[model samples]
Target: MAEAAWGNGELARAVNRTGTETGQRLKYDASAVSHWLSGTSPAAKALPVVLETLARRLKRPITAFEAGFREMPTPVDKSTDTVSGLIDLGSLDMDPSRRGILTAGLYSVALTIPGWPDVVGRFERLRTDPHLRIGMAEVRAVAAMTERISTLVDQFGGRMARPMAASFLVNTIVPYLRANADEDARKAMLSAAADHCYLTGYMAADERHDSLAQRYYLKALELAGHAGDHLMYCTTLRGMSVQAVNLGHGSTALRFAEAASSASPQAGPRMRAFLTGQQAHALAQTGDKAGALLHLRTAEVAMDQAESKAKAGGRYDPSSLAYHVAQVNYELGDREGAIRAIQHSEKVRPMVYRGTRVRHRSMLAEWQIEAGRLEEAVQNWHLALDDYLAIQSGRADDRFRSMLSATRPHRRNPHVRELLERARPMAGGRGSARTAQGAMT
Candidate 1:
């Protein structure tokens, strides 16, 4: 029989809670859970997520498709079902060039839908016709404008960033994609528009809305493939992989990184090395010290190769550079290295990245705790916690728990205790230190 929710909508409520908790949507049919319990597998693409979801609920490890699915032969109540319907496209592990793109896109769509018409109908008609030849300068100009808008987002805040980025995607880039008759130019413009999405997605990650961030990243990859921009495709995959690892989805991150690495040869020198660096990070997260070290060494070689050309072909940006180096070191238990990397990041990044600054500082505080700088760590954590709550980051909330566990040994220590207490709120949803940071708006 198919799975059915019990009385009072409790099951549905549980289903939604678990789905949001595990980053998956639950299936209503309970019988599919039986098919999964038998030798039959759920869909291959989302199999990993589903397996993890069940394992989490059952309090055990359940590897899907291992031993032909028949080993798990007993039917059981389907308390949770993670959605695994999302495609396992290879580019989920690209660079974070497109940070907060989707939130911006969604926000923009909501805003413009009520106000604006497709005012460019005449322009759109003229641009896409095959007879009309677009100048190379126009393409370059559009690309340049896109880059500037991304810059503005970083230098300013999201309020300014989202609209500017979305405008470029809708106006210059997509119009070209829609209007151009030439296959190559159409491809070029589509890729550019897709890049805007990717950049905004990266911004999402900075805001700590990881799941939403991920959706945007994937969309960018889909668009990039249509443009046949293999380098961009590889970059997008690397970004997603980085995000996976960042959010503690280590194995998923590794798989994405592996795909990016395999796809690297077709990518440029910078992106090729970047993918390897991502693998190094995944290994570190999995506690494969020797393997992690080896990959790190490999990454070093790749970084050197990528840097040798001296010409900028979409290499790691300033925040990414710090985030990458710090991630590997943080995973490998090298607190000092993480500290140095974060310090460097603080210097290089502009104030435009107000949100990014909060995260980089959080990482720095993490290094402080590891390095026995308890007071400093506490201060940083409080700051980060405040920033995190404002952004509504469940991922950050989970990370905060992990951080607390990591520092549990020092719980009785004065600095730790005091910091913890200072970090607490006056109950009834009032007077949180986070509130003192002022309204996030």
Candidate 2:
């Protein structure tokens, strides 16, 4: 069917041209065309363009599903479904069984990679609905709720807080967004909604629900564009980058981090530092030791500048900077360096950052295990386990699982055996200790 519309070489050029028009730099060739004909899926960003190119040649619309491409649910039209779609997503996220199903959905960083530029381009095209009446009081209320939920997530972890945050979005914020408002009020409301969406997305990621996290982040980005809030857009992109790196897509993560930095060149020092630190971590994951270190240094400089200009406890926190440093060092195989950085993070972390503290302690113990200091590792793990038992967090559970896997070899020892028994019940539906032990190996 593709060959009937154009010669093989011509098809590749046409697809590439279409992609370029959409701000995507695609390099499809004759071989790529042959691969596509044999049922290979094109890059996510290129797929629509490939179809559109074919449609142009055939003088009709060509749908991917008609060409034997895998069937995917039709995406929500950004123009209409932004609010209601978010509400539905929030409702689904709040249901334990439905949340699990959503989490099990497939994830692909490619789908997000090519959309960054397009998001920025759409900002200028946003239109305001004059019928929706809203004011500063309502916007302030949403912002205040967002801040409170963020604090709650920091202290209690996202397991309990995610649902509450989602509920607020569905019950309170969405209605205000849909209410009659002038241009300024509408933009402010949209920005507030975007911030809330980003927070929900972050909490979802903390709980290891990557698929839901991706959807929330995309929705946040769409809201930000409509609100003409470039900073929020950059923040949402950074969140996506963090999730991507956590899932081991370093190259895609780097693209997201870089895009965030590039799209907001006028961002404050603290924002720049955070974005650069994320880039360093992604580069470390990709095995670019020198590049990672260079970015790390750049991030440090940015942090110093931020501190010089403003007091702490604003948008950016110093503890987060240290955590990113620890992550970069760990990825670079610097166990000692990673340990020191995490220790610094622990010292500087605010009291309300309980979940973050637990995660850092867990990481510290893992590094100790790698360093052959089993006694110290055991001590740290005990502290981590106390927090894990108290907090409801899937990420904490994941760390505990990793710890159990690492300690399995020594479980025959009295101390290790006792710890294993203590950890078994906490594994939560991951099955018995024996099952976990077998799965680890």
Candidate 3:
């Protein structure tokens, strides 16, 4: 694999580049590659870097299991491969012993594989089964269930909601997809199933299960194409971009974002605004400060147009727009701008979105820390913790860990020490500040 991806001394150089991107200073050479091929497993951190390098060169998703570093049973159905993949992912995700495999690092880069357009096109030609009957009511039920699940994810967190979503996909939605229905009903059902899969994928990502989340998102994108729902297709692509950016794949992130925008040229103002904001975030990540700022302005203008054209209801929420602005600002080193945008997000955030509220508060605290307002940062961290303790979200846990890591240097200060002591037990199984420091090394 190493020679196939890079000739001679290039593999070591590629690994070093990946390490630099990931903030590690690896010193692997051809000797390490020889050792790896001879059955010596790389270090845990190095394993991901290696797999990611191969996946990037191969232009597809790669897993530790596929590389022979671990054993896992592959699914059988070639026809419904993506669906089968989802089932396997959900099963693995729900298994306590196996869940750790999904959280492994550097998997996000694999998510930017350029084959999704082809996958979408191929799936669109698929014919539904002609046996078991399905109806509009079943389709509506899936849609309604998605709305309720979205609420649950917002209030409780994906850790509490993911199992329910996975079960629904496996038990309810998958069966409907396999059932017979009129052409129109089948299309509706496909759309509904796509929505459910997207939600499940989103929750999986929120739970820090990137591998599972990428599979679900791909499945969702395929189903959306099959249904000929351009909007849903664009949405799934945008979700992929979000995941890529979060994992620090800036160029790939920008590609996915631009692809989403291109896929939906005639989208409404609200949808356009959301897509543009995603582009802004990608630009910010790639150090295109001017491009990022330009897109941010475009997003704001698009949002205003969306609001003005709202006849009965608005498709895009202002809170999402504000959140994107904050993210772009943060990426571009505008801490004050980030905080102001976050405040706007908070103002419009619905009361039911407690999990989002917790995240916003955490970001605010992080910004406060960046601004050297230690006392204010501690206060905000305390407020964030109050809400964080109530949510069962891996994303929230990530924020909590980040808080601990950031405050570690100031632990000698009374307030920082007090927060650190309080957060120790709440760290769940991720360990305390000491372990976090150890991991950094």
In model 2, state the lDDT of residue 116.
Answer: 46
TM-score versus the correct structure, for each prediction: 0.60, 0.78, 0.82
lDDT for each of the candidates? 0.56, 0.78, 0.78
Question: What TM-score number comes out for model 1?
Answer: 0.60
Local accuracy of candidate 2 as per-residue lDDT tens digits, 340-360: 999898898777777877777
Q: Tens digits of per-residue lDDT for model 1 on 199-248?
A: 86675564555555666676576666666666666777778777778767
Error of 2 at 275 (Å): 0.6
Tens-place lDDT per residue, model 3, 128-166, is 556768899999999999999998888788888887887
Which ranking of candidates, highest TM-score first? Answer: 3, 2, 1
